[model samples]
Target chain A: MNPFAQKKIFLEALQALRLKKKPKETATKTDASVCPSCKESFSKNALEKSLFVCPDCGHHFSISAQTRLDMLLDAKSVRFLNRRLQGGNPLNFPSYEAKLAALRSETGIYEAVVTAVGKIGGVKVVVCVLDSRFLMGSMGTAVGEKITRAVEYATHARLPIIIFSASGGARMQEGILSLFQMAKTAAALERHADAGLLYISFLTHPTTGGVTASFASLGDVILAEPRALIGFAGPRVIEQTIRQTLPDGFQRSEYLLEHGFVDAIIPRGEMREAISRLLALHGRTTA
Target chain B: MTTPKPRTAADRVALARNPLRPSVTDYIDHLFTGFFELCGDRRQAEDASILGGLAFYKGTPVTVIGHRKGKTLEENLRMNFGMSSPEGYRKAQRLMRQAEKFKRPIITFIDTPGAYPGIEAEARGQGEAIASCLALMSRLTVPTIAVVTGEGGSGGALALGVADRIFMLENAVFSVLSPEGFATILWKDASRSQEAAEIMRLTAQDLLTLGVIDGIIHEPPNGAHEEPASVYLALDAVLTRELSVLCAQSGDALRKSRYKKLRAIGNRKEAL
Candidate 1:
């Protein structure tokens, strides 16, 4: 740290993440974490025991892609896919390369989304889990290519696929090419769907922008975690355009269920059971 | 392909957003015949922003759809200045399916700021609507073409842009979002739009090289708005040539080719 690295500047850096929820003031000295939705704090071990779900208010804290993989996949049944495909300074956007590199070492992942083939409930499936830690899980060229290749693989392998999306939208640093990723991913999913393969789109917190408007919304059965912000555009953009404060719980998973956009709101604990059950049912023949 | 007079990104952006520029309504009048405008998603409401229906393109039955731009404030309000709601996209999807069922060619003229970002739009499932359109268009067996007549904005424009062939007019601009929005979202300064526009590489020439678009249709020296008839003629020539080739393919062949073309966007040979 610089000799003059003050508390204020450190705090500002934490808040500058552009995340839907700011980190809960990381200056704490205790071995406890606070829930952003509810004002309750608990020991880190307690939070992990509940899978980071707030025991009091039931708020689902975001989890890392690795944490999610460990929770969903069976023991030693995971093989990563498309790790060679990662982001570049495609448009030469200033500081983009530096930011991506910083994120790489910080998150220990090559890109925002991690694609792999793994077993869920002992049933093999191709899975994609978008970690918002890197660029808010934005879909740029590499993220798009990885997903397209994932869907293509599932189509070829006759495997059901599930994608847990946690994104802000298109990666603006990559410019128009980021927006085109929407079409690219959807086009690949079209081939997958045509083969009569099952696709379950699992939207996590803060899935908006290009991601929501693409493959996330195209899933035959779309599922979301409780209270995840899933929509085409962000709430701030919508509020600014509408000139009105959104009603309570607007654009939330519950709201989407009320509006029929999502099939169900499955909690983090139930996700594995729900997804694996769907995959099993989909594989069944007429009886 | 570079021409003698290269337009700065800013210049192309300005020309594309010019109010006097030709709109989808004008193009339909000039090129299509026996036009019958379709309305309503048959779900709840009719979105005035996107207008689509049956038409004859040079005596060939086709389904035409596009974002509607208006000349007056009231008209623009009626059309929501071409920013679609979920219903607009649903209407487009309905039309695309109709075209596919009947085996008629589909042509879409894209020009919009984007899907309307408002409370009502979200309430109606805007993302699902656009995603459904892309899914349906990607697999459509009929010949399809999408032209960026003016502004091709984000998912709203892309909802209709998953085509077998996509072209952009010389002055038209297509990007993830408006330069102003980009600057605002990234830097919290909308005035940096010109700088953002430059980096966006949204012009037809840039997109062609990037393989984001298939071709470009040249406009007159003054601009397409100044010489609407010439713009129409040029587009007519391009569409006629392209459609003849696309129409020759079998349904299975067309489906495969469209899938391959769209899948190639981020799969650039210089992939990371």
Candidate 2:
């Protein structure tokens, strides 16, 4: 077995040992959660307190955009931007409209990205966070427009910008129009940079594809959640293309930091504090 | 003298993918002198799909980059059938940055089906790599030109195509995605790709009319493959002329104009 696969088995066994003592930690407690990576179980409330990071193995679970906003921003602090912007089926892709409708109701997300003006550690900032639950947070025209507008908003306000990227890539259903967002968002960010404003990119679990290609990698300071997978392409494709087995822990945040792709691997628990410290250092303060 | 038979969008696609067509190497050999290839992205293994190098165009030193499509099956496999990986775009970015630093005029040839669509490519951040290239190319201070020599398919083509001036060969096709993909998605019939090709506004003439491309280079009676030497000569003259005109401008001017050009793409005013 692959080294990573073997490690996963060992972790499962260890977790089984812990579970043996607790007869109540059964499937009936489905509302509670288990870390797929470390196989450690926790009550949903406990996991929320931990910010969804697995305490034992440091695995970062995919958090919804709403949850992320709640964790990162102050109480009742968010003023959403471009909430009404949505993508039309430009290519008239069959079933795309229906799929969008289904996804909208299912995810409670209008689009893949949520752009908002919010307070983080009492510092005002514009944020565009990607919700992976919404079609894997694919970058469509609407998502791109939202990000660009948010960056523009930050530039105009002279406030800092923070973006949390979690995407599979350009929306396949949107066709080339979707791919073009990479350029659109990047161009907007370039103008934002011209204003000499600060932009922070927070990479969560599975930040890949066009999102990683553009604004995510263009941050003044880039940070990744602990053990988050951050890369342009996944390991399986790489392995298949090159016809070779990949090294253990490939494309993980720790591996990326070692390779100088990211500034640091920040655990979820310390993320708020870290952002606060960064904003303070940048001399950006709330009114 | 018979006029060149009118070609459909699907026919043009076939022409673009024709095995006998002149590849990037042919263009380099016929256009530039003292060509020296620079490989590896430095972050990962070298990607063979994108061929980037330094060469002297006419009497001036320049940087040349283009997709490398192979005519033979073995060579095509080696070059991933001209489909680039994340490392491929990164390698292009590395060279482009170098070009910007040295003030060398950058010329790129666009001819790819798209970036490789595979699990590993996505894992590696293929979209990010391509997006960075678009962002980087847009802001590069040096003069930049891109030629759509064949199939300018999706983000893969756009990666090298965010230039100050974009020109397409008479038979080349540039679209957001492959017609087959477009057809499959829109019509639920992949065989209706020909219909998608027509509706996509992807042919050189359509793109030029739409102002998506700056200009189009006229090919021979059949296509570029029918007369490679003449096609290369025509491209050479146009490149030299454009390079000289662009090179006369300040780097800041080039950067500003490039940014404006990219921003105006989907804008109502420009699209109108």
Candidate 3:
């Protein structure tokens, strides 16, 4: 069985063991603060059919990279790059590699990101999708290399590039090397920008840190997904440093758009059509 | 008693021989004869801080864009203390695009604290404005050169900095961020600006060593402000020579060389 299923079984057995000795605690009170939609929770299979959203309230949880790719790209158009690229425990931090291995086993993804050359609405472009499941989509050497290679490919082919960023920032295990990716990716985007090719960066929920400071902000037309968090440093860090409370909706996608940091805030459902319109505006077509 | 009389006019004339002040305006007028000053971004208002127009340097037509500071409070306000807004950058871009279209070699003189930081500026998309200028300058098909005449700070300098050759005056500094901002961000105190300045390695000599700048133009003793005329002559000579070399290349070669030149920056390190 997969690790996720095995872990679920282990948790169930532990709960059953607790239940066996709970005869005297049968009248125990339970918290009444559960999500209203989750109160009548459906089976996991049923949730999968609804895109992992809450059945009643339709609260959209995060989706996997594969699901996002399937929904975004043209049918059978994704040609994945760098499947063999994986992370390393360079810092020798305790249990880093073990944790990564367990995550790999559970998610079946090699890295935090997947890069591909695909067609979105018949427009040939390079697309990089960040998977939040793997280490919260932290950017490491592999992620950086994949992005740099994608930009290089787009520059060589004279094609537009599109990247959907959903990162928690640079990977800590990689140390300063992860920080260097900021400059590396910026330089790549510099070359691509110099080529007069369009680069559209789509910022998703929780985009922050070194990524926001680099190529993510270097887009010719920067678009953010609804309610995405985009900033160089977290509000808590800034507030702690400055010793002041932040304003409402600080660093949210709508706030950034209003503040002119992003060009527009696009909803996930309409992203493909919006991207197609932008590509068409640029007179770019599929190969 | 006879020698105690007031000195003659000759003594006063000899005393006035301070090397600091010279015939700077006269020399610049002669060297850059037929200079025409252009104004406005054509989209909105004009910025006095950045001056750009056609100028004849040694009988050759060249486009000159440089930051110009004022000597008085009113003029300083007019010039915005040399901190340009989006209009200023757009004006520079307009001249650059025109120069490229006309196949004329371009020379830009950079001297700005940074881009203007104001709520109105942000409302008009300052980052996007700078990004647009960078994009436009990078793709221009003309031979372009940038001379850091003074402070070269962040995106303000970078907007007009994409060129085949970058020359900086000896005392000038070019950096990603101002020393004060660097200090505040890295040290958590603005008082460490001097320390931040030292660590940033912003001097022209340092940048030359890092391959960030192509060459450094020697300034007169004390600085450019001391001998403005002699400095202008020296700058005019260097600008003429660089422009001549760049102008010798074809349009396609110029574009290719500029692209390669920009691509070659910041490629020195390996993973540590």
DockQ per candidate, 2 decimals: 0.67, 0.30, 0.07
What is candidate 1's lDDT per residue for A1-287, written digit by digit as tens? 23123323322322332233334443334588989988899876556556678879999999988778766776678999987568666677888888988999998899999999999768899999999999899999999989999999999999998999999989898877888889889988988888999999998999998999999998999999999998998988888888889999999999999999999999876777788789888976867
User: How far out, in Å, is residue A265 in model 2?
Assistant: 2.1
DockQ score, prediction 3 = 0.07
Cα RMSD for candidate 1?
Answer: 7.0
Worst 10-residue lDDT window, candidate 3 chain B:
B9-18
TM-score of every model versus the real structure: 0.93, 0.78, 0.65
Native-vs-model 1 lDDT?
0.87
lDDT of 2 by residue, B23-115 (tens): 889999999999999999999879999999999988888999999877788889999999999899999999999998898999999889888
lDDT leader: 1
**lDDT, candidates in the order shown:** 0.87, 0.80, 0.68
lDDT of 2 by residue, A1-287 (tens): 24344333333433343354322222334477889997888776445545566656877889888778877776668899988678776555568789889989987778999999999768899988999998888887788878888988898999899999999877766555566677778887887888988999999888876677778888899999887887765565467557877777878888778766789888766677788899999993557
Q: In terms of docking quality, how is candidate 2 classified?
A: acceptable
lDDT of 1 by residue, B190-264 (tens): 999999999987899878977889999998886898888998999999999999999999999998888778767
On DockQ, who's better, 1 or 2? Answer: 1
